[model samples]
Target: MAVSLFYRTGSNAKEWSGTFEELERKQAKLRRASQRILERHQTQDGLSEDDVQHDLKQQQKLDKSAEKITEYLATHQEKTGIKGKPVKSNITDPDSAKMITSKGTVQGYNGIAINDDKHQIILQAQTWGSVGEQQTLVPVITQLKQQLDKLTKQKQPNEHTIKFTADSGFNSEANLEFMAQSGFDSYIDDNQFRKRNPLFKESETYETEQEKRRLKRSKGRPRLFTSDDFHYDEATQTCRCPAGNQMWRSGVNVNSYSQKYTRFCGYLKDCKVCPLQHQFMRKPSIKTGRQVQFKNDESRQKLSYGDKMKVKIDSPIGRRQYGKRLGAIEPVFGNITVNKGINKFTLRGQEKVNTQWKMYCLVHNIEKLRNSLH
Candidate 1:
């Protein structure tokens, strides 16, 4: 058996009822109520000192309400802190995160699923509050491994080679390295995988959208000189800026993620004299010259899992195998989100939300089994 495993993000964008959203709604209501309460106590004529004191007490009440809301935001959900420093907790679903969907910002858990290519049966389903999908791959695979082990114990051969297919969201250098170490044959699309194929380049749609996105990000400002604008000399181990000024290798360093890069900087004399100084450098005001970083060959090899996947996925065999992924996974999401009307999760905590998701996946598998038998 080919034993294809397809993984995908679930479709339902959970309706955000987080503490932040709830707080805004509650604050608006409280403001209106407080205003009415203050108006009732206000004197019709010019206010006396007693009237002023009463108004101050009413204002104090409003301040106390706001203070209480702020305290709740600060103190609530201490155990499961929000990612990238705690800002505000979701009052309704503290475990869920505010994710930016195509529609807009949504407070919800990201639902993940793994499916069998044979019958489109869901092998695993999980819910995560993290907006990033990079961290979820290992967990999903671990769960699937356990399930497969159980099946092997039931007399099925465990020697079959398993191949995984997923979209660009699950792609990462770390994940790719993990797959190689674990002996998994996975075809995970990188963000730029499509650009490698001649067909995609021939098509104007990708190019057009890319230009639009680039223009949107640039916001009418002239595009600054990127690293691509510099020419490298492999023999000399030097770089030349777009203005033809030679740059010396400043230093070699590795980032927090262990990615290595070499920095190049032009002489202050050269950069200061260059006409393209403003076009190339972001900091011409400073006395320093222009700087650029180039990824070394070792670094490229270490982090080019996406690039490797591009070569694999561009092949006819690769395309045929990956073609099965969408069909295997998307139908289940459609069934759960669209057909079953599970547009939003009603559950609260992560455990409960996960259980609820599995229940729906179970329903989907049962339906698939029923249909196959018919």
Candidate 2:
């Protein structure tokens, strides 16, 4: 499956950005305003005064309920957790999600398209409002299966013939296990896949000229120690800072982008008096000490579905099959987005936006047909 994000017509500036504290304050202010209106009417003496008093009492009761909600919100602080961010819903299109594209973060939808490798024709396409693609594999593949059955006029479509290959974005343990159990040939790359490739072996060395100029610019400056400077022993499961002080293991396994890493932290006491602390630490008055993370290497004997897929994708045959993906789907998207100029959706709401994306895919297929007749 080939997926991409397209920015729509909304901006973060248009979004009502605030923390839980701010929201609590706003709710409290609203509750106070309601109370004032109720109190102002309570003093009035006229016909239906009983009804007015009853209505005012009900309003006050509603305000008290709102106050309870605000109180809960006020006490709990909003935090940006690891691999988390402030979720903003746009006033214009509430269904659109906040996406980080190559250009930058923008309000958009993730449009996914599965293409026929032979002709690079879109087999199935859909748009989702979620930022992550990991959860989309099953639904998209199920749709593709239905489409394949319809087009091929086969009751039982040869699932073996049609292999599903996707990028790392769709790769999850569940997804890999699904593909494996369903007996579908697949290839999905891992984060460290490129490290195995010889093409990037001299990648750092190729930028030697740039590095020399950078070093020359900061000739007298001492190079600050980074996470790489920290020594970690896998056998002992121990970490030591650059100053030769043993650090405490803060977290056993921290997950990021489907990869696990062990987190280590230095004690403030140890970091405070270290002679090389200034060289490694960000600041002298820092609350905490240096932190380092080392990638976890799970045992091959106990390989998970994701780990097995990683090994498969790094294979020569897997690389060859996966290599066809860019040509199969990318140019089709590039021609539609760049050549045909159908980049962003001009509609609002999920149904409308999804319809527009499918229409674009249909247009691309039509163009392909037109070229084929010649």
Return the top candidate by lDDT: 2
Ten-residue stretch with the least lDDT total in model 1 = 1-10
Pick by TM-score: which candidate is best? Answer: 1
Alpha carbon lDDT of residue 343, candidate 1? 60
Per-residue alpha-carbon lDDT of model 2 for 1-374, expressed as tens digits? 44433334333333333445555565677687787767767676563868787777777776875675565555544544226775444434556766677777777788888887777778778887667777777898777777777877877755544556787777777877556645356677766666665357554532468755765776723345655555466677886554446678999879977888889988888787765565666578368888878778743123366655654555445567778877777788788889998787777678988998899989999989898899
CA lDDT of each prediction against the hidden true structure: 0.65, 0.67
The C-alpha TM-scores of every prediction are 0.57, 0.56
In model 2, which runs have C-alpha deviations exceeding 4 angstroms? 1-14, 17-87, 202-301
Clashing pairs in 1: 18-90, 18-91, 19-90, 19-91
Q: Write model 1 residue lDDT over 79-151, tens digit each, in one string.
A: 2342454343554556666677765776667888888777888887888877677788888887777777798
Steric collisions counted per model: 4, 0
Instruction: In model 1, state the lDDT of residue 6.
Output: 22
Over 4 Å off, model 1 = 1-88, 154-160, 203-303
